[model samples]
Target chain A: MNTFVLLQVSEQVAAKSADMAAKDPHGIIITAVSVSVVFIALIILYFAYTFIGKLTSGQIKMPKIKLPSFKKKTAEVHPTPEEMAAIALALESKRSGEVYAAIGLALHQHMNEKVHDNESYVITIKRRN
Target chain B: MNTIIESLQQFWQYTGFANMTYQHLIMVLIGIAFITVAIKKDWEPLLLVPIGFGMIIGNIPITEGLNVGIYEEGSVLNILYQGVHQGWYPPLIFLGIGAMTDFSALISQPRLMLIGAAAQIGIFGAYALALQLGFNPAEAGAIGIIGGADGPTAIFLSSKLAPHLMGAIAVSAYSYMALVPVIQRPIMLLLTTRKERLIRMKPPRVVSQKEKIIFPVVGFILTAMIVPSGMALLGMLFFGNLLKESGVTKRLAETARGPLIDVVTILIGVTVGCSTQADVFLTGSSVKIFGLGLMSFIIATMCGVLFVKFMNLFCKPENKINPLIGNAGVSAVPDAARVSQNAGREFDKSNHLLMHAMAPNVAGVIGSAVAAGILLSFLG
Candidate 1:
C-alpha cells in the first residue's frame, strides 16, 4: 500500500520479465530430430525401392521346395478287405498336404515346358469361399 | 414526456452509446464483407459464411442469446469461443472431416502415399521456427497450420491450439488453398526435368473390389494403434471410405456428403472466424503469424519436391516416380492434384498425372492429421 513498496514491486516484476524475454530459447533439438527422422526415412524408402525392383527383375531368387518322384506300382495284385482299409488309412492321414500357393510349381514348370507355348499363360482367378 | 426521455436514456445505456469504438464498427463491416465473399465468391463457404456471420455478431456488442451470462464480464462472442478454448471444436470438426474423406486412392497406390506423409514437414518445420521466434507452443502450432494444405485441418488445429490466432490462421489457410497453384508451380517445375515432367505414368493396376474393401479396415487397425489421437480423424476418414467401398451404404454416404458434413463445416468455420476479434486481428503478432504461415507453406512445397529427387537416386527408370507429383503430397486434396496436372501439362499436354497425384494429395490429409495428433500428444 505504501508508494515506495509499490514502486519496488513494479521494478522487480519488469526486471524479471525483461530478463526472461532476453534469454530467447531455441527449439534446436526438436527441429534437428524431425529433420533427421525425415532424412532416415527417405534412405529407407530408397533402399526398399531398389530392393523390391531387384526381386521383380530376377536378381533375387526365392527358395524352392523339391517334390518326390511318383513310382509306378511294382507288383499289381487283387486287394483284400484289410488291404483296402490300410490304403484308406494312409490317405486319411495326409491332412497337411494342402498347397501353400495354389498355383503349384509342378504345374507351373510343366505348363512352361509342355502345356503353354513360350509366350504367356492364362491365369484363371478362383473365387474363395 | 419524462417517461419517454427515461426510456431513450435507458436505450442509449443498453446500446453502449458511450463506449462504442471505431475499430469495433470496422470489424462488423469486415464480417459483412467476409459473409458476402463466402456466399457469393464461394471462398471456402463452409467456414467463411458462418465465420463472417459470427464476426458480425460478436463485434456488434449485441446477441446476448449466443452467450447470455458473459455480456458484462466479457463480450458474448468471447464466451461462445470458449468451446474452442476447451479444445472441443477442432476435434469435432476433425471428426466430421474424417467422416467425409475417402482413402481408396491412397490404398491403391501405396508408394504414392508417402508423398502425402512427406508434405507434413511444413507443419512441424514451421512450428519450430515460430517457437524459436518467441511465440509460445500453442501459437507456433497455430502458425504452422499454413502447411496443413487443407483449410479445415489448418482451421481445426489452430482453433484448438491458439484460439486468438484462429482468424489469421483460417484466412491464411483458405487464401493459400486458393493459391495452391501459384505457390506450388515454381517448386514443381524447378525440382523436375522436362523429360521427368512429361513422364507418362503407367495406369495403376486395377484395384479389386476385395482390395478396396479390406484396405480401410486394415489401415484403421495399424494407424489407430500407432497414433491414438488420430483415431478421431483417421477413424472418421476411413469410416467414410468404408461406407463408399462397402457397396452397401449409399444412404449413409449420401447423408455424410450432404447434410451432416455440410452443417458442421458452416458452424465450425464461422465459429472459428468469429474468434478473430478486431483487437486480436490488429496485433503485430497476428501479422507474424500470417508471414510464418506463408513461409511454412512454401517450405513444405519445396521439401516435398526435393524429397522425391532424393528418392529417385535408388529407383530404376521403370519404377521411378515422377517428381512433379511431389507437390501433391501436401493435403490440398484435388486442388493439389489440379496443380500437379497443370504443371504436368506444361511439359506434355497428354501427360495426365492428376490421378496419380491424388493418391498423395489424399494421403497428405492423413499425414497432417497424424502430425497434429503427435503434436497434441506432446504439446497440448
Candidate 2:
C-alpha cells in the first residue's frame, strides 16, 4: 500500500511539472534573456553617464549677461536729543549683558524712516499742556 | 390600458436601476473605499480622488446597445480613454515631470544611478515568475513592468504589449507607488543595521547651470540611441528638463510642469480607474498580477538595499553610503526619497538624506523607462 501511494504521488508531481512546462515552454530562457537585457541596458547607461561626466565636468560655461543697476535715493537725518538718550540707555544696558536688546533698541530708533519731532520736544509740550 | 401597461414595462426595462448587477454594486463600493482612503489616510489624494470617482462612473450599468461606457465606441469616456489606450498620456506626463525635475542631485553623484539600475532586478524577476505562472510573453511583460514602480512607463509598455492587462497593470502600479512608505520601510530596516543606517553621505557637489542645461541635451542623444522604443517617453522627459534649465523658456517650462501635467494626470487617473469593470478586472489573473506586483516591489527594495551594502565593501571609510537611501532606487520619485529621509531621521535627527536620496530616486525613473523599452523591443 505504501509503495502504491508513493508511486501515484510521484506520477502526479511529474504530470504537474509537464503541464507547467507545456504552458510556458521557454520560461527559464525568457527570464534569463529579459534580466540580462535590463542589466546590460543599465550598464550601458551607467558608463554613458560616467563618460559624459568626465567629458563635460567643467567644460561648459554660460555667457554672463550684465544687467543695468539702478541706485535708490537715501537721506540721512540727524538724531534728536531723545534718540541720544535712548542710545545711552541701550549702551548702559549692554554693560549688564543685555547686548541683543540694547542693539535692537538702538537699531530700531535709528532705522525708523518716518520724520517726527524730537522725543524731548514732544514730551515738554505734552507736560506743559 | 394594455398599451399603457406595455409602455411602462418598456420604461422599467430601459432604466439604469433595472440594469444594475451585483458586480456594479461591488465596484461602486470599491470606489467609495478609494475616496475614503484618500480623504482619511491622505494617500496620493491627487491621483486617488479622481480615479476613485471615475471608478464609480465606470461601474454604472447602462442599456446594452447604448454607447455610454468607456468601452463603448464613440462614447465621451471612450474619447478620454484614448490617451491611455493609444499610449499618448505617459509621454506627455513625462514632459511635465521633466520640466519640474532638478537633475543636479543625480548629476553630482552619478554613481548612485547604479543603485537605480540594480533595483530593476525586480522587473525581470517578476517577469520570469509571471511566465512560470502561465502568463504568455506579452502578458508577463506587462505584469513585470509593475515592478518598476513607475505608473506612466508601466502604462505605456502594457498598452503596447498587452492592451487587455493595461487597467490592472496601471492600477496596481499606482497603488503600490502610493504605498511606498508603508511597503518599503520594513524591508529597509531589515536589510540595514544600526551602523549602516547611521552612515552619512557627503553633500552633493553644487552643479552649475551650464552643466544642468547641457545634461538634458547630452542625455537625450545617448539614451535615445540606446533604446529607440523609449524615445517618446525619454525624449519628452529630456525636452522638458531642457526647457526648465535653459532659463529662456521659463514660461514654457512653467506651463508644462503646472497646467499641462495636471490635465494629463487627471485624464490618466480617471481613464485608468474607469477601465476596471467588474467582469474584466476581477479575474484570477488580476489576483496573480497583484501578488506579483507586491513581490516585485519588495524584491526591488531588497535588491537596492543589498546592492548598497555590497558597494560599501569596496568603498573607503570616508565615502561610505547610508543604506536608507537605497529604497529610493525604486523610482517613486519624491515619495521614496522622503521615505529615506524619514527613516534616517528615526535613527539620527541631524541626518538630512533627502538630497542624497534624490539621486537614486530620479535615476530609478530613467532606469525603469530603459527597462520598459528593452522589454518592448524583446516582447512587443
Candidate 3:
C-alpha cells in the first residue's frame, strides 16, 4: 500500500514539473524579447541624442535684429558766464529755502508734541449747538 | 429589563471590539510600525505617512454589509482607488515627473543611457524567478517590475497585467525605493574598488534651450514609434516635458508638477495602502512577492555596477566612468543619485557624482517604462 501511494505522488509531481516546464519557454521568450527591445530602443535614443548633442554643440545662435536708430539732430547750446553765475545763484537760494522749510516743519512738529506720530490728515469742525 | 438587556447585547455585537480578530490586530500593528518608522527614520515621509495612516484606517474591523471598506463597491475609497485600478494615476504621475525633471544630464551624456538599459536585466531576471515560483506568466511579469524601483511604473504595469497583485507590488516597489540608501550602499561598495569609486568623468556639456525643447517632440516620436503600447505613459511624459521646456506654458507646467502630482500621489499612496487589508495582504504570496522584489532590486544594482565596470574597459583614462554612480540606474530618482554622490564622496571628498548620476537615473525611468510597455504587449 505504501509503495502504491508513493508512486502516485511521484507521478503527480512529475506532471506538475512538466506543466511548469511547458510555461518556462514562454517566460524565456518574453524575457529575451523584452530585454532586447529595451536595449534597442535605448540604444537608438542614445545615438540619436548623441548626434543631436553634436549638432547643437555650437549653440543655435538667434539672428541679431538691428533696431532703427532714433537719433535727434540738434544744435549745441552754451550759456554765457554771466548767465551761468545767475543760474548758480538761483540754485543756491532754492537749496537754502528747502533747508529752512525742513527746519520749520521739524520745529512745528516738536512744538505741537507730534514728533512721534503721523498726522491723521483729518480736519475737525465743531458744529454750533 | 429583559428588552433593555437585549438591545445592549445587539449594540455590543456591532462594535469593532466584537468584529476584531488577531489578523486585524496584526495588521493594525504593522500599520503603526509603518507610521513609527516613517516619522522616526525620516524615510519617504511623503509616501509612508499617508500609506501608514491609510493602513490603520483600512484594518479597522467593521460590521459586514456597511459598504465602508476599500474593497467594497460604491465606497469612497473604492472610487479613489479606481485611479490605481484603471492605471490612470501613474501616467498622471509621469506627467508631473516629466515637468519636474531636467533632462539636460541625460541629453549631455547619452552613453550613460546604456547603464539604464542594462539595469533592466533585473526585471527579466525577476520574471524568470517568479515563474519558477509557480506564478502565471502575467502575474510573474507584474511581480518582476519591482526591479525597476519605480513605484508608479510598478503600479501601472501590475494594474494592467495582474490587478490582483498590484497592492503587493506597489508596496514592495515603494519599500525598496525608500531603502535605496541602505540596500544600494553595501552593494555599490562591494562591487567597485576604491580606485574606481574615485575615478571622475568629464563634466557634461551644456545643453541648449532649443535642444531641450526639441527633445520632447523628437523623443515622443521615436519612443512611441518603437513601442506604441507605451503611448499613454510616454505621451503624457513627453507632453509634460514640452510644457516645461517650451517656456510658453509656465502656468500649465507649474500645475502639472506641483498641485496635480501631489494630489495624485496622495490618492495613489493611500488607496494602495488601504488595499492591504490583512486578509488580502498578509498572505504567503505577499511574502514571496517581497522576497522576489528584494532579489530583483539587488540584481538591478549588480547589473548596473558591473556594466559600468565593463564600459570602463574600453574608455580612455580621462573618460572612464565611476562605478559608484552605476547604482543610480534603477530609476529611484534623486534618491539613487544621492546614494551615488554619498558613496563617491566617501572615497574622495572632491569628486561629485550627483549631476553625472542623474543622467542614468532619468534614463532608467525611460528604460523601465519601455520595458513595462514591452511586458504589457506580451502579457496584457
Candidate 4:
C-alpha cells in the first residue's frame, strides 16, 4: 500500500566548523579515499575468485542438428498427362470419314486452348495523339 | 563651528568609547582573522568573512565619549544583532541551504537516512556534555544540536532556546564543517581493522530513475511518521527534490538554487558573525564549547564505523556493504565521499567506492537535521 504524496524542500551542510576547523587534529589522516581503496580490492578479490571457480568447473558450446537440401530445376519443360491424353483422344476420334474431318477442323481452332488453363490468344491496339 | 565641535567632543565622551577595554580590541583582531580566512583561504569564506567583518564592526568603539555610553542596548552592533536575537537567521539560512542542496543522493539511499540519523549523536552527546558542565537545558540543547554539524539548525534552535549562546553555536557549527576531514579520519581508522579496511564492495546495482524520483517522497513520509515535528526541515528538503524531479517546475527549481539561496547565505553568515562581539566570544566558555563539539564529531564517526561492523555480521553475499562508506555517513557531503574514494584507491587503483559512499554521506545530512528537529520540537 504505497500512497503518493507531494513535498517541498531544501538542504543544509555547514554544521560544526568550529571544532572541525583543525588542520589535522590527529596526524595521519585516514581519509575516506583510503577506505574506498580497500573496498575496491575486496571486490576484485571476490570477482577473481568467482571467475576461477567457473573456469575449474566447465566449458561451453551449442548442440548440432542436420537436414537435407533440395536441388533446382535448371533446364526442363514437360507436358501434363491430361493434355497428352486429350490430344490422343482427339486423334482417335478422327479415325473415320466425317468425324475425322470435323475433329481436324476443331483441333485447328482450339490447339493452344487445349494445353492452356487460364489465358486466351487475343490482341488489342492502343492509339495515342 | 567651535561650539558644534565642543558639543561633539562631549557627546563622544558620554557614549563610553573613551572607556573601552583591551578585551574589545582583541575581539576586533579575531574578527579580522576570520575575514582574512574568508577572503584568502576560501575556507567557508562567504559566511566566515562576513561574520568576521561583523565582529570587527560591532566591537569597534562607536562612541567618542560624549552622550551617555551606548552600552547594553544602544550600540549600532546591538541593532544589527537583533536579527540573531529574534531566532530568524537560522531558518532563513536553512531556506538558503535547502535551496542550494541536492537531495538526490540521499533519495537514492533510503536506509542511509539512518546514518544521517546516526551522526546526530554529536548533538545529543554535546548537549549532555554541556549539561554536565552546568549549561541550562535550553543552552545545552543548542550546543548539542551544534553537533548535528549544521549551522542553521544550531542557530535556529539556539535562537529559540539560547539566544545568548547563538554566536558560539553558529561559529562552532561552521568552523567544524571545514575540519571534518581531519576530525573524522582518526575515528574511522581506530574503530576498524586494516583487514576490514581493505574490503571492497560491489557498486550499487542499477538504481532506476523512477526509484530516484520516488525516494524523497517516501522518505518524507517515513521521517514524519517517526517525528512529526521534523516536518519543516524534512518537508522542505523533499519539496525541493519534488521540484527538481517533477520536470514541471523548471523556473522554481532554478530560483531556489540560484538567487534565493545566495542572498540568505550572505545575510546569515554576517548576522551570525556579528552576534559574537569580543566581549562575548573570548571567554573560557567558548573554548569549552569548541572542545565539546570536536569530541561530539569523533563520537559520531565512531558510531558510524561501528554500525558497519554491526551490520557485517548479518550481511548476505552480494549485499555486503563496504564499511569504509561508514565514514561518509557523517554530514559532510562530497568531502566525505571524496575521502571514501581516496581511501579505496589507496589499496587498489580500480576501487571506486564514492558512488556507494554517497548513499550514507547525504543521509548524514538528513539524520543530523531530523535529530535537530526532534530536539527542537520536544525541548523548545
Off by over 4 Å in 2: A1-37, A48-129, B1-5
For candidate 3 chain B, which ten residues in a row score worst on lDDT? B159-168
1 or 3: which has the higher lDDT? 3
lDDT tens readout by residue for model 2, B1-380: 99999999999898868988898888889889888988999988888888888888888877766778788767888888889878899999999999999999988888788889889888888988888788876677789889899999999988777776777888889889889999999999999999999999999877878778877887777777878888998899999999999997887899999999999999999988998877677788888999999999998999999989998999999999899998899989899999999999999999999999999898888888888887777666
Off by over 4 Å in 1: A1-24, A34-129, B16-20, B36-42, B63-100
Task: Score chain A of model 4 by TM-score against the reference chain A.
Answer: 0.24
Error of 1 at B62 (Å): 3.9
lDDT of 4 at A18: 20
* lDDT computed for candidate 2: 0.83
How much is B77 displaced in model 4, in angstroms?
A: 6.8
* Docking quality level of the chain pair in candidate 3: incorrect
DockQ for each numbered candidate: 0.05, 0.11, 0.19, 0.01
Flag the better candidate by TM-score, 1 or 2. Answer: 2
Tens digit of per-residue lDDT, candidate 3, span B216-282: 8988899889999888888888899999999978878999999999999999989888878877778
Candidates in descending DockQ order: 3, 2, 1, 4
What is the DockQ score, from 0 to 1, of model 4?
A: 0.01
What is each predicted model's overall lDDT from 0 to 1?
Answer: 0.66, 0.83, 0.86, 0.61
Docking class of 1: incorrect
- Of the true interface contacts, what fraction does each candidate have? 0.07, 0.29, 0.50, 0.00
Most TM-score-accurate candidate: 3
